[model samples]
Target chain A: MASKPECACGDTSAVAGGKKRIIFPCAGTANVGLISNAAAFQLADEGYGVATCIALLGSADTGLRRRIAEADEVVIIDGCPATCGAKIADLQGIAIDQHIVITALGIDKVYERNYTEEEVERVVSAAWEGKGRT
Target chain B: MKIEVLGTGCMKCKRLLKNVEVAVQELGIAAEIKKVDDITEIINRGVMLTPALAVDGEMKVSGRVADVKELKEILKG
Candidate 1:
């Protein structure tokens, strides 16, 4: 396999009032998982910070780990209660600033890959509202 | 040169270690390869994914297996 080029040079400067945030979406194949992915995109598009790859973080990719470490806030958009993203982050000693479990937000986890934009918006709005904040 | 296979003793991790050994032998390079199954050590190495390859402390790959050819290229470098 070809070695992947490392994009370790990410903008570490604060985006949201001196807060540099990174979002980790579970991005599972299931519906809730898809929602999490969509929400991440929306969040990034809304200038909430960049949406990052969970696999790279799980692999402890050097550049990505550095980015996570530098970020003021680390958000995990887990698809379900299993919280795979959070679990992965924990293993890497990543201190999560905000945790959002889609199922916990009163959204049903349908096996089918069907989710409306509103559902994605709900997660995005929840993120802005700090609903998942401790 | 020093090479390390990072994993938690999973089947795939062992397989990667074995593959690396074969690659070194086939290439006729005198390289020392070690299996890092210790969790703390692996974490300190900055790896959360198993079956990872590190050449001289630089991570080559992780979260997936690389074939003999790929290992050979990494070793050659």
Candidate 2:
């Protein structure tokens, strides 16, 4: 039997692409935070960019700092208007190319983590559509 | 008591040094404050972020510039 063709589609770890993009999601305990995290994961699975932790930047991780500096585009997703992810990026001197707030998308910020895939897709589409450009 | 300021000479680091001095003076504690300016040395001490405060060779905080009030709290406790 002939070997099947290799399918590397939607591989978030595929670094061979021309432009390198990294995403920082506000993975807080709230619903909006969960939404932001889920959206980033879906986007990463779709080969949009690699999803990374914002806490590393908060702690000033040297390796992650260098990666952020080298990335072509850095996306920051905040769960609410507080924009904790954006603030961390700023504190660590990391420039943000896109800043998305889930609350601004008409998504209510709730303490419970009850987010649907539709909401996650909405955020993913917002990222792809460049709606979060600051 | 040994209070070390770990940084690579950023503006915040300079501010942190001043804050540390004032904190020590205000508390009237016999503490030796040393500024660690080398990047490699700072990282070797397990501090990737500049403008960090280490008390008795223990990492307290990093990345953010803690205010004088916060410094006092950290130093005292």
Candidate 3:
């Protein structure tokens, strides 16, 4: 049997063919904040989007801000109502396509440092589902 | 010269401000320094990160704290 060719279509990690999507997660101290960060990482690992540092956005790194401004889609995941992630995007005048607050997903906020895989998945799904909405 | 430190009043922001002051004092430069805490103004100035420094309306450093040595170098330019 012949070996099948490796399909690398739509691989953002390798290529820059299409519009880029950027994800910013609020890596706060709270458990919910950590969950959002985990979810953003998972989404990026799954090739849903590229997870970027919220601090970089907040700091207004010119290169990073330019990338955010030029990105085709921008998603912000905040852990709580503080909405630091979203606020950074808003302050940068970047249009966010999706804004997910982990607490609003029925996840209680705790001042812990760990989060479960399932909790992370739930946030990821919510953020993913938010895509393609008019 | 006009210098502005932009941040949301975070610890790093305060530290950056202090560093800037120290740098200014050491350099003996008669520069006007301002602290920008308003989110709207910060955004309008295209600064996304707190602890950002702008010299004469041009962003010089951002997203991290610059030590006195680093601030001196940035201000010397």
Candidate 4:
């Protein structure tokens, strides 16, 4: 029996050559917020990027901020127009290479507790594709 | 009493700082208030949100700006 090949999509080191791409998700209390979080986690798990804490960024942690400032790229995911995650990065003068808004993807912003796997997959694909970049 | 406010000097962070000052004054407490504006230092302290309050190195409030009333409760504790 032949062994299955390892997925290169999950090899972050190989993709970035040791550089890190950070992702920040709003993770708000809304459905879209949760979807953003799910997408971010999926991207991290797939080695597309490292999912860092948005709260830590908001707190203005010098180390984390420095890491962001020096990162090769930064991705921000917002559940709604509030753009909490992106705003935090902006406050610290960190530039966002890509910004994804779940609501802008045609997902309604509601208080649902659960989201479909398809929705999560859509977000993951968008992030991986670096959508919302000019 | 030692109180530390963690933030990067944003509007909300400044509001939190003001609230803390007002709280301390109203309570007539002798406290050492410090503003942690350095991002590296803020991260080392394990704060995940801005405008956070730490009492004697212990984190208490985070993420949101506490009103004067809320600050009073936090300082009192």
For each candidate, what is chain B's TM-score? 0.94, 0.94, 0.95, 0.95
Candidate 3 stretches with Cα past 4 Å from truth are: A1-19, A131-134, B1-77
lDDT, ranked from best to worst: 1, 2, 4, 3
Off by over 4 Å in 1: A1-16, B1-77
What is the number of residue pairs that collide in model 2? 0
RMSD of each: 17.0, 18.6, 19.1, 19.2
Cα lDDT, all candidates: 0.77, 0.77, 0.74, 0.75
How many clashing residue pairs, candidate 1? 0
DockQ of each: 0.01, 0.01, 0.01, 0.01
For A80-134, candidate 4 gives per-residue lDDT tens digits of 9998888888888888888888888888998987899998877776664445553
Judged by whole-model lDDT over C-alpha atoms, candidate 2 comes out at: 0.77
- Candidate 2's C-alpha runs over 4 A off are A1-8, A11-17, B1-77
Model 2 vs truth, CA RMSD: 18.6
Question: What is the RMSD of candidate 3?
Answer: 19.1
Please give each candidate's TM-score.
Answer: 0.56, 0.57, 0.55, 0.57
Q: Tens digit of lDDT per residue, candidate 1, span A1-134?
A: 22332211223242112247899999998999999999998777645669999999989899998877777789999999999999999999998878999999889998999999989977876676555764
TM-score of model number 1: 0.56
Over A1-134, each residue of candidate 2 has an lDDT whose tens digit, in order, gives 22222222343233222246799998888999999889888877755678999888799998998888777789999999999999988888788888999999989998996888889977876776566866
Docking class of 2: incorrect
